[model samples]
Target: MAAPSPTDHKNRKLLGRLSLPESRFIADALRAETVGGVLLLVAAIAALLWANIPAISDSYASVRSFHIGPASLGLDLSLQHWAADGLLAVFFFVAGIELKRELVAGDLRDPRAAALPVIAALCGMAAPALVYALVNVAGDGSMDGWAVPTATDIAFALAVLAVIGTSLPSALRAFLLTLAVVDDLFAILIIAVFFTSEIDFLALGGALVGLALFWFLLRRGVRGWYIYVPLALAVWGLMYNSGVHATIAGVAMGLMLRCTRREGERTSPGEHIEHLVRPVSAGLAVPLFALFSAGVSLSDEAIAQVFTRPETLGVVLGLVVGKAVGIFGGTWLAARFTKAELNEDLAWPDVLAVATLAGIGFTVSLLIGELAFAGDATLADEVKAAVLFGSLIAAVIACVLLKLRDRRYRALTEAEERDEDRDGIPDIYEEGNPEYHLRMAKIYEDRAAEHRRRAQKAAAAALQSAAGSTTEADRPA
Candidate 1:
């Protein structure tokens, strides 16, 4: 190339330093959340319209109540029940895989980083529950639905953020995601403990045995769908018969899968399965469940009754007001007590707006509603209305708050670009003069020291592992 031009050589150097592209699997999963949220919304709307219109309400009811499974195995259930108890298991399975990945190698793998979201999730769940309980005090069975507002729907909340929070800091999204994951774990626990009626240990034992086999197969690198599918279905059936919310089986299987990559393995089985299953869960399972569960009769009488009931009011208020207060309050308290500072790129206002977005508890809230009022169709309808209404209100308020924050963030970015000296320091920070530059220099030095320490630790670990492997290789084998 004729002793490459100076500009061309510089471009080649810069290109060499660039990072590799991100895995497409992860990008697709994130994008699927937004698409799934829209599809879920559409399904809920379609169900509502079908249930409300006088011409098709009866037909909608007929289709929902229709049964078609084998009764000999206690598997015969209404279409709605199948959607809730069966299809939802797929969604939970993907959630379980994601949870395992997070616990193993993701943000939650670090204790200090995980603590903020764990505390926030616990507080987020508790506040909504307490608000529901306080509202339903002295009521007969209304207190049974206390867990209704305790969930934060990850896909729905993320969709809202994706739509209106383009300018928000990445840290805010990370906080929200971690908080929601923890909340889902708690919600699963609630379902297993509170919602389950009569547990048959024999069936549960069978499910456990099947799960053990599934785990063994997975660890051995047995990736055949035919082998795993039958085992999974058997486990689901046994759990369903055991009355432990068949979905728990999915969670159990997900958590049991080996997350670490073997020496010769291209990817961990957890990641492989998650990549394959997440699309089905997001596109089909969740929307199907929503279509069935969200078909509440939105009549004038139903609307009046929904507002009149303490249970409905409790759910609405708990989700709207309680989620915001709990998440924000918990974050503040954690940072205060632990002496951990918030990210410099984010503000308290951004955290508050994120907390509001946490209130959009759609998927799990609806599931809890169905469980809370299993036999009583009238009460179930009321709970559905409350969930829809509350989530909608939360979405609107979150959009407004995020839009304002987006404007402020854009202004901040513009101000930072106004730096004249090209010293890489924002004008606002530069106003403090020499002391600011000295502090910046100290920060750079500290960061460099930390990087060196990490590199040394990693090298030592690799050396030790290699030595151990060499010793084993030289042994009897």
Candidate 2:
């Protein structure tokens, strides 16, 4: 075999080390998602207990089935539908904003940096659907649920990482985030394309007009929650009535938002909106959706059906086996064929662990399962059980692998900290010498000087305005 060139070596590495800002951002995002994941888990558990405990199970069903909203506009839907169709739109909206930010400004802006994750995400999704389809075909079952195992729930995956991979490289988290973001985009496309039953052209046209108005107002710098809220509600309603999944409206609006900040602005409009709405989505919307959607009856028969039913069985195997193989194999193939290589800090084992973690497809998987078997309530419940069981198995396996990796990394870090050179300084602190500190100090000093100049300029302008006002008053007297 020929030796790889330096440029090839540089370009080929997967999960390369992240920049400080990017690392910090990932950490913050992981923390937030960890909380959301916990909430989702709690809600799912509560729902299961409520639905299976004979005394309260009927009430749970009744609450989930109760209808609400206006009937005149075809807006009346059961509480479960509201959680699935309405609140999930908020979750997808946040997802769309993150996707936009990443594509426009984050690591995804560079095609080279994006290629690996993009390929992995594509393969990750494809493999699951393929697995599901093959299983269903062999068993003579329906193919509608092929997409059920295709999604990777970011909240659950990140939460698992946060808990088990503290000493692992930040690059792993970045890779997972990028992969999940691309996964979300593909999932949205799938829902919008395959799930629609019919199109109400007029209503769809009205929705498009509303979206255009939204873009126009945002571009024109029109600001006010009152105006945009009503407009957004109208757009969502029109979209729902158009025979399209209403969540598409949220994704559309999120993509349209400006992701870059203007001069003097601390954050972009998309960032600000995500910050404001993320809490609502995480704390309320998603948990409520889980509460309503995850209330599957876990009877002994239901449990057996999850394994025996071809469609449901496909969901289980797809998530537990297919996701791991697809992601790991895709990344390896990309590196083997292309100039890219595995990141020096990460090993094939780490990638495998992360890939396994990706199999916890909780939220979107459930949504697709419901959509796939909408008419067969029994089948849908069985599918839900399968998803829960599969995700649990995947989570446990990932947790074990990640914990092992974390221990190794922790030991490596400790070893690095203990080793010292002849100069009596630890090798780990060599890069943090006085020279590096001096350079950082210089940078801070220059920023401080620039801030002082701006402050003086503003003060001078204020003083000049006050003098002009005094002169005008004196002259008038």
Candidate 3:
């Protein structure tokens, strides 16, 4: 077999180990996403219930249809429009920040590290879109909804992973996160390109100028919500009036933020801003969007139409089958052609499980459904039911697969913890021997103590020098 070259070894392992800092960041992000996912699920349930109940369904529809906001600026919109346009902008802003950070500093910064997920994300998107298009090819005017199934709801997917994949390798989580992030970026692009009606160049120019000012101020180290909030609103409104999706404005602003930290800084301005805004996006903005957007009548007729309507059926099939096939197949093809190999800790089944989990296309799917069928309320409602149904089916199936994998991993972990040597500690921890760690720990501790002592001595010498200089000056030199 022509003695395997060192290059072969180097090329091995797709979704390879992450750096400690990157791992920590992923962990923190997953935690936040898990919470957000729960809130999203709750909000979705509330919406469905509110819309379906016989007594208050009318009230639910009326409330969502209620219009408020100043009309002069073209800001007057229904509650649902506000949720989809205004609030979802916050969600997209957070996504944009995440995408920016990933490209600038996270795993996606390295082409080698990024190649697999990027490919998977693109394929994942293409597959569902293809599936949707194929199903709706015969149906007149149904092609517009192809993008509806292309998105994977990161929050919902991560939430499911958190609940069921507790023992799965971190590489799986990292892969899913990166894949979803890329998926979100593409979804935004599709919205920008396909869903736009007509451009009011004047409004678009004003939005561009506002974005430039915002970027310029940040570059100049200008800060303060008081200064930026109104600017952001103006940009959003202008973008809305410009006939482009207003959420794009949020993304533009987020991308313009500096993602790398400066010297002596704990976090970059982008990170700080994300930290401040993420909770709002997750807890309020997304949940509210879901509450407004996911409220479809799940009557027998609506549920039946999800299967019978060509566009709705395409959405369901595209999300449920196409997502899994695309992500898993794309990953396999990439690994086969490229030098990359799957991580040893993960098997094909694990990949399949993650791929299935990616099929939970809830939030963004609902948003796109609304956009795609803006003039047809009935068709849009059917698409909503289709998204909910497809996502639910995907989640249930993924849960089963993940639970089995998690159990296997738990068993393996327990086996590794066995005290084979009859020692007080587990075999895995003691494999490297505690004595070696103790020595290393001692060396680092001594080095830290030495560094502190030097700092103190340097401070004392500086004080003495200052005191001598003052004394000399007082002597009338």
Candidate 4:
């Protein structure tokens, strides 16, 4: 055989670069998010079961009443309620962080790249609301739940994707995730505005002042949360009292950090401060929020009530059916409008499957349901039922559709790639062609890494579709 051609050498190098080393950090992160999600699910189910057991009712009451908080705040909350209120705020902050990342560098970065997901997300939101409202238009006030099924749970969705493995084209998975992230941005906006109560002008003013100061500090090149952290707390308190949700503050807090120079002459004080607080938000705040908010007293008695409860039914149906129509239909319409383009790497079947998967709105759905009906105990109960009910349905739908879609799509895509490179120096992987393997490995590794980061950021945001009072900030006026 003639000496390996230059093209062959090129292919080997590329493949080598593409191969992924199993970094402990990545593996740990995957476990952190995956296990964390699973734990929340289990804890929630356990709570629901335990609360209903006659012997555990009193114990459940005790559990709910148990308080948790940092001593410094001179505060401790009723365990159950605190989970909904206090710990959730940190969850919101993390949501904001993830949202910021998406807008800056991830799925939402390029308008063209973002089109399919954006459209799908919008469709997901509108279709669910319309369908829910149409189903419950009796002026019975069940309309409050129009927002219920519109959210997607990012972590849970990704977990589903993991199970499906190489069956689904990576591109489709990414597109669906990006769509979910954008949908979450809208959901956050809706909660801050529509679901909120009356506002306190003074508190609103303080939030504005905080915003102004934050902008000024950014302009002045201040990156430290020194002045900002306290302001965030004050904003949260004010917003909480202002009739606006508090968690909006988390994003407001992050907005300042987003302004930090991507590439500075040196370092950023404020950005560093924000970074230090991030783990607090992620590790402590979010977990606590999950434990607290995920609880539902799923007694048989409650089960009977859910069928008659609009909020409960609305949430359940919306998540299951609404999400499917909205996400799938919207993506189809958008792609058709945009030159029939999906992700360059994905096909329509793949898109639909991923959209189905996007319907699994667990974490975010739970969080928002709590916020949307916070003060009303009866309503909160109904909302809880809806959340659990809707999320359960959505998860099932996602798992089934994704399983089927990926299987067909992956095989088709692989065959097409093969046809594209049937000649000598064939596709990225040909046994006996070391160069090709190296090149293929590099492409897969680089693209996959970048793609994953964006998807994860979007995913992190998507998980907060249910992010309600778990943060502090003035909702936009």
Candidate 5:
């Protein structure tokens, strides 16, 4: 047989890798997102701390001023805001694309599945803004920070779940994720509408035209990332100049990209594009933004500043108090008044704990704060102070609450593990393992198959009992 072509060889290699079990791959992806997000957060906090120190603060201002864009093209921007505003737009844009995908083809498509999160998210947004306004005694001028608490940081929140262990149920985990995705959509919208300044109509028109051309190419079955990248940059530059918040560029570009992974429509290299760009978006795009935006000028009086200003108080209160009230209370009210129901396995306390964790608003809050108080240094600094304080408080409170809950529920698992120890099997699966470790995980799976069969039988008998009861009641009536 002839040797496979280079492209074919690559495809075969990809297929072989994919044949390495999907669950393991997904688990690894989650692990990476979790660990990486935490690491970036740590770096961001360090930058903030270092930037605030007496002498070190002076060095940061200089470090951030180094320009990287084309001096020849006269497009140079401050490297500080460039990473945060310019590149992080790619992150938001990728986020927007994912949001679109979820709405069109993923969990958000089903009315039953989407309804709860959508409604809860709306309440989640509205309640927090109202709460924030009430606390800040906000007027139109100071009201610019209203949307600060509206986001749900997925990786950070999910990391809390991972730490909580068995205190949370799988259903609760699923609910929070879906709800957060919805929350992200709302936050993006708030950014687009509220944070945008003024528009350059001609430039915007040109960007729209570029977007149209991109869509046309996508429709024509173009599968090249090269086509999308230049156009995407054009879109960002135009939007940046047009006062539309440049990160919206990623959204438009993603809408132009095709995700035709189903049967017999021409396959696009969207995944390949992502394989190239996601690292750039994740490793560089988000982290760089965090590094720049997270540099808060903290003094010895940083702690005291928390309750001093209205904007600072608004941010801190909105996230710590507003998030818990909005997410959990909204969720509870939805379940009570509407036809929505809580996940079967999730306790109300766990739900509340997860919602508290959702208040960990580090990334999007910083992004919005940057936009809202663009030129107002004092306001921006206050906002950053609030964000750091709120995020830290929420993270600590959520972790402690979930830890207590986990300890309460861990008795059975602890007992079972002890039994296993007596029987001489090693406790190798303490926290988690690498993807390779799961290749030999068939024994537990085989036992699960038998358990599932028994479960099906039990469900059948329960269903029959309910049906017979219904029949008897109808006959008597």
Candidate 6:
């Protein structure tokens, strides 16, 4: 790597002056996601170590299998179940909010623009599932996990891309984000429809009523946690009893929140909530679940079984081979069928790299694996092994591909970042157009003037309030 120039060091110092939220946007949320992925990976690694070590494995197993919660309410679940069903609800809630925002007002709102990712996501899901089913067709009930490898863990994939593809195209990042969002929506639906069994209509109805009341409260601008918290729990519990995954309740409630900005708010309530809770979900909830869920013992016998079993092989192949072919081929087919061209900034090779990265199906993949082989502990462990193996392979392949194209990507990133006038627009766009530069400058000036006006108005209000207080004091005297 080249040594940093003096200008680069100065730029870093300048960036240090930005506030936390400002730094987040400047870093484009990539840093946060990457950090979260690192934490999650660490937690999973810790779990694997704890489960494999003879001294620690017993304690690990005991803690994971221990029951908790109110038994009377049929809510007494193992620690692993709590991690999978309870904590992951928070993660899904944030996903729901993002999905709603995208559908209502973001990129997915436009049909033509959304077509590419939506189509790619659908095919990306279908191909892996088909592959898994084919691979396990002769196996005994292992085909139940066909959906296991279909998911794309956005954080893990993004983290890998962040570390290796620092100079990758922004368009490719956006495409991956959109595709993953859609992929998650599909995964949720699959869980709801295929995984759920024996629904209790009474509890389901109660959940519906609670969700309705929650939506009403939100519409009435009731932002009180006291009001929402108990109601949310009620909905989640009801959904749990109703035999649907309780996490779906979170998604439902998130979708219910208003996505468009309301009067006097800088951003929508949904966006605000997501911004507040995403750190909790990414940093704590998901990582904790990973720790609880990823504790597979990789004993010699288990390792041999993982290779020998058709189901385990299916998951591995589905994630590593199925995902790459599905994602890349899906994108190609989507573009061809829609008569849409790839983003001008993204090449087919870049798409291939991203598709390979998408194969890192860690979080949701494990969850599905657990649910799929819930009847047999041995199969469940095998599934976990397969997921870890497959995801690691995917990460390795993606790293190599991304590194191969790193130089081209680096040059592109540099050109994009070059802004000689420092007007918030890349210099390339403003190079030939003095008028465009002036227009941008005027916009910034007008925004500054508006801020000044708001500040003056606030000062005047403070002065009036002070005078009124003085008058009240004189009257009392």
lDDT of 4: 0.60
User: Distance from true position, residue 361, model 1, in Å?
Assistant: 0.9
Error of 2 at 191 (Å): 0.3
**Residue-by-residue lDDT tens digits, candidate 1, 1-477:** 001011211222100111111112233345677788777778888998988899999998999999989998889999998998899999889888778876876556656656678989999999999998988884443787899999998788766766664544334555666687789899999999999989899998998899889988877767789999999999999999998999999999889876666688777778777778877988899988988889887778877876678999889888999999999999889878976665555578788888888999989999999999988878988998998888888888888888877877676546544555556545454665887777667877888999999999999999999999999999995
Per-residue lDDT tens digits for candidate 2, residues 393-470, read 999999888887777767654544443333443344456577655655677798899999999999999999999999
What digit string (tens of lDDT, one per residue) describes model 6 on residues 38-90? Answer: 88888998999999999889999999989999999989999999999999999
- Better structure of 1 and 2 per lDDT: 2
Q: Is candidate 3 or candidate 6 better by TM-score?
A: 3
Residue 474 lDDT in candidate 4: 44
In candidate 3, clashing pairs total 0
Worst 10-residue lDDT window for candidate 5 reads: 1-10
Count clashes in each candidate, considering only residues at least 3 apart in sequence or on different chains: 0, 3, 0, 32, 0, 0
Flag clash pairs in model 6: none
What lDDT does the true structure give each of the candidates? 0.79, 0.85, 0.85, 0.60, 0.67, 0.80
Q: What TM-score number comes out for model 3?
A: 0.85
Please, what are the lDDT tens digits per residue for candidate 3 over residues 1-477?
011011122454876655435645776788888899989988999999999999999999999999999999898999999999999999999899889888888767767767789989999999999999988886544787899999999898876666665654556777898898999999999899999989999999999999999999998999899999999999999999999999999999889888887788778888889889999999999999999989899988888889988899999989999999999999998999996767776688888988998999998999999999999999998998999999999999988888877777676546544554554444444546777567557777988999999999999999999999999989954
lDDT of 6 at 397: 92
Q: On a 0 to 1 TM-score scale, where does candidate 2 land against the true structure?
A: 0.85
Off by over 4 Å in 2: 1-12, 162-167, 411-434, 437-477
My TM-score estimates for the predictions, one after another, are 0.80, 0.85, 0.85, 0.71, 0.76, 0.84
Better of 4 and 5 by lDDT: 5
What residue runs in model 4 are displaced by over 4 Å at the alpha carbon? 1-35, 65-77, 138-141, 160-168, 223-228, 259-282, 342-347, 405-477
Task: Report the C-alpha lDDT of model 5 over 1-477, residue by residue, as the tens digit.
Answer: 011111211222101111112212233334555654665676687778768778788788787877778755335888876886688777776666556555554446656556556876787778768777887674333777888877767666655555555434323444565677788777877878887767889888988998888888877867666777787787777777777877777766765554435565342344345445666676777777777778876665765776777777878888888888887887777677754444333367876787788788878888888777888976787788788888778988888877877764464334323323232422333225344234335546767898999999999999999999999989954
Model 1 spans > 4 angstroms off: 1-28, 138-141, 162-167, 263-266, 409-477
Whole-model alpha-carbon lDDT for candidate 6? 0.80
Name model 5 segments beyond 4 Å from true.
1-29, 71-74, 138-141, 159-168, 264-272, 407-477
